[model samples]
Each structure stands twice: as structure tokens, then as C-alpha cells.
Target: MAVTSNKQGAAMQLCMALPENFRRQDFLAFHRRDADQLSEHVTEDSLLKGVVWQGQPACLSLFFTERNVSVTLDADTAWSADGQRTLEAWVGHMLGLTQPVAHFEQRFAADPVVGSLLQRQAGLRVPQSASAFEAVAWAIIGQQISVSVAIAVRRKLIQHASLLHASGLYCHPDAQTVAGMDEEQLKALGFSRSKAVALLGVARNEELVALLAQPVATAEQAEAVSSRLLAVKGIGPWTVSYALLRGFGWLDGSLHGDVAVRRNLQQLLQRPEKLSDKETAEWLRAFSPWRALMAAHLWAQQSSAGY
Candidate 1:
């Protein structure tokens, strides 16, 4: 991946190539699903989001076209050459540009259920968050709640713990920021006491996030990450799977525990009722190494079906 950067005053401007299969519409649509729409902003052909950059609050903007993207970082100080490259790579990862899904399309073209989705939603990649901690926190917040409600709680948490960028966008709180808050504070923000404890536990666990951020290239590696996450109190299979998918762009995490996944599976299979989570897990095992992508297809199918 080639990157070019220019520092103009307080902003770092960058130009990076987009993958051929990159679907701008899908990317924007995926982010637009964020019910909160607080820290992240999405437009027809661009994205603007606040993130903790180099341990400081910053806002990154990306204007997308067919073949390439232009990025602007709003920060207090100009980034060094290395920082610029790191930021560029992070932006690429966050946009899912770093993930190649052609193999998935090729491998599943003959699959009856997913083949059609692959054709319909070609170029779809799991969009990642700014950090693993952010993804984990979202997973915790979203557990057993409606997306809108979870988003509202998340917005409140951001307002309580986050800093605003010059662009007036609030940066999602980093682990240190969230960890510093008392459990009662998070609970006051609508987090259940259990969730508050879990979030705080994960946030204070500095090494866990670092371990999860590493590239997961194999089943063994993914399992190791899962083991570490599961060992944490209040972290479960669904939470770990979601964090892996949305945080590390890991493609194989089984999402059978997801309600929407099971509901869509019931519809797709023409069943009278949604499959139990255990049944869904069994069915999803057939698509190992691509279950998460299959889950993505099911989610897209749900949206298209107006479910």
C-alpha cells in the first residue's frame, strides 16, 4: 500500500489507494448504521470520526472516490514521519481497505446460501473500530439490549468521559479514560452494574487489548485470543466474537449466538422459528474460517429483507 502525506499547519493530509473491490456505498452504509452518530459522522462519499490518536484526541476525515481516498487528520501538532505512516495504516485498517475478500468470493461462489449474498454484497468487509477497547466496550454495551438503546447509552458514556476535537466531534474514550471512571459513573450512564464491571475490567487490562490487536491469521491464533478474552469476567462467546470481527477484522469468529443471525437463518432456511443458539452454532460450523463473513451476509440479508 502506497501512502503520501503532507502536513499543513495542524492537519495531516494523506492520499491512499483504495482496493479495487472496495465498495464506497457499502462502507458508508455500514457506518451510517451507528444509531448514536455522535463520535462518528458519515456522508455520501466521505467519513469523519474522532479517535484517540497517539494518546491524544484527534479527528480523522476521509473523502472517498472510486479508486482512492483523501484523508485529513485534525490534531494539535503535526505528526512525525513515522506517526504519519502509522496513522495512515490505521486509517486503512479502520476502513477495511487492508482486508482482501476476493478469496471469500471465489471460495463461496458455489455456496447456495452465501453465493447469492456474495454476489449481491460483493466487496463488503467488516469495518473496524479505532481500537480493540472501543469494540469491546461496544460489545459490552450492546449485550442484551436493542441497538438504539445501546447507542444511546454509548453516547452518554462518550459525553461523560470523552474529549471533543476542534471539529466538535467527541473522541471515543480510550481505555485509560474509561478505566479511570468509577463503576457507579458508568452505571449512571445506563450500564448495568455487571456491564460496568466488565467494561472497567477490560479497560484496565492493558495487555489484553494489545494481545487482541495482533494480527490473527490462523484458527489457533484466533482461539488463543478467544481464550484470553473468555478468561475475563463478564466476557462471553458473543462478546469475544464481535470484538474480533469489528476490532481486529478477524473473519472466522462464529456469530451463531447473534439474534439477527439466527433470525435471518430461520428466514433463509424457510423455517417456522428461529433456530436455537446451539442449533445455529452447529449450522454455522459448516462455514468455518468464514462464519463471520457469512454472518455479515446474513446481516445484509436481514437489512435487504426489511427485517
Candidate 2:
């Protein structure tokens, strides 16, 4: 990573090379789902978002070139070289640059179901959250609600709990911030009592927080994390799976319970109706260790079906 700075220590830019077959349009479209521009700002050519660095707010501006993505961090204070490397690593993780999509493609290119998606979507990868806290909290907030409503409620939560950066963007709150929030405060932001409790429960629990922060590098580790998360109140299979996918970039999460995944799968198979969650789970078993990637493909398939 080559680093460049123009504002002395207050700003720095690092360029990361994009892999061959990287799906730029799909990645940008995924980021565009933040319609309200609360946590992230996305344009046709670039993305601007905020992050918390060493207990301070910072802005990340990402500009894509033909071969590389340039990430520029702007902050009020200077950070050590190690701190800067940490931020660069976080940005790479969030952008899905570290995911092994190539290996997935190599393994599934001849399979049914998702094989065409591998060919069509090419280098599609899972975009992770800045932190595990954001992923789990988002999954809880989205439970039993439409995506649009969930996005709106998430914006509300960020507005209420996040810190404002010098660049006028709100950084998503960390676990400690959310844990410190009162249930009534979240309720006032349109979260149901149950969701408020659930979000707080995950955030406040020390064991859960530590587990969330753990590096999930293997299937066994991922499963252990899922088991622990499911034991928490207000978290279910769907929530645990979703959190694992978004937070840890664990690719095997079975999202058969997701309505859109089932509906899109029906369309993919030309079935008369969406499969039941059980049937969907059974069908997805063939794609073990890559089911979440299949889900992402299904989502992309659904998003482009209108045209």
C-alpha cells in the first residue's frame, strides 16, 4: 500500500489494487442502499463514509480507478503509523477486498443454482460492516420489518448515537456507545421495545462483545460464534446468520429464512411459489460454506430483475 499525504498528518490516502473481474457496479450498488446518506455517502464515482478511529471520528473517501481503489482518511488529529495501518485494514475489510471470492468461483463454477451467478456476477463479494457491533445491531433492527423501514430506523439510530465528524458525516456508533444507550432512547427513535432490548442485550454483554470482535478464520470458529449469538435473547437463526455474514465475512451462513432469498430462488428455479424455509434450508445445504454468497447473488438477481 502506497501512502500519500497532502495535509501533513491530518489526512492520508492509500491505494488498494482491485482484483481481476472485480464487480465494481455491483459493489457500488450495494453501498447505494444507504439511501438516506446517514452513515455512508455514495456517488456514481466515489464513496464517502465516517469511521471511529482510536476514539475519534474520521472520514473515509473512496475513489475508484480502473485498477485500484484509493481510500483517503480525513481526521482532526494525527495518528501513529500503526494506527493508520489499522484504519487501512478496516477499510479493506469493509470493502470486501480481503474476501476470497476467487476461490468460491473456482469451486462452484460448474455447480447448479449459483453457478450462473458466479459467471454473471463474477467477482461479487460480501461487503462487511465497520465493526461486528454494527452488523448485529443492524440484523436486530431489521427483524420482521421491510428493508425500507429498517434503513430508516437505522438512520434514526445513527443520528441518535453516532458522533459527528469534522467532515459533517455521522460515524456509526461502536458497541460501547450503543451499550450505554437507554432502551427508551432507542424506542423514541422508532425501535420496538423488543428490538431495543435485543440490541442492548448484544451490546452490553461482555462475552458477546468479545466474541463479536474475534477473527473468524475457520468454519468451526464461525459455528461457535453463531451458537453463542443464538443463545442471546431476541437473536434467532436469521439474526445470527446475518450478523456472521456481515460482521465476520463468514460465508457459510444459511439465510434460507430470508424472504427475498427464497423468492429469488423461486424465480431462479422457475418454481410456482417460494420454498418454505425448511425446504429452502434443505436445498441450500448443497452449497455449504458458500450459502451466504449464494444469497448475495440472489439479492443481486432480484435487484436487476425489474429491467
lDDT leader:
1
Model 2 poorest ten-residue lDDT run: 1-10
Query: Local distance difference test, per candidate?
Result: 0.82, 0.81
On residues 1-307, what C-alpha lDDT tens digit does candidate 1 reach at each position? 6678888888888899888778776667666766567888988899899888767889889898888899998888756768787778788888777665788788888988768878878887777777877888989999999977987898899899768888888988988888799988998999999899899888888787677567676788889888988888888999999988888888888899999999989998889976999999888888778888778878877562111
Cα displacement (angstroms), candidate 1, residue 302, comes to 2.4
- Model 1 lDDT vs. the true structure? 0.82
How does residue 261 of candidate 2 score in lDDT? 89
Can you write out model 2's per-residue Cα lDDT over 1-307, one digit (the tens) per residue? 4444344468777777777666666666666777788768888778888777656888889898877888888877766767657766777787777787888888989887667877988888887777888889889998999878888888898899769998788998888888889999999998999899888888888888888888798988988888888777888999998888888888888999999889988988899976999998988887777888778878878772110
Instruction: Report how far off residue 227 is in candidate 2 (Å).
Output: 2.6
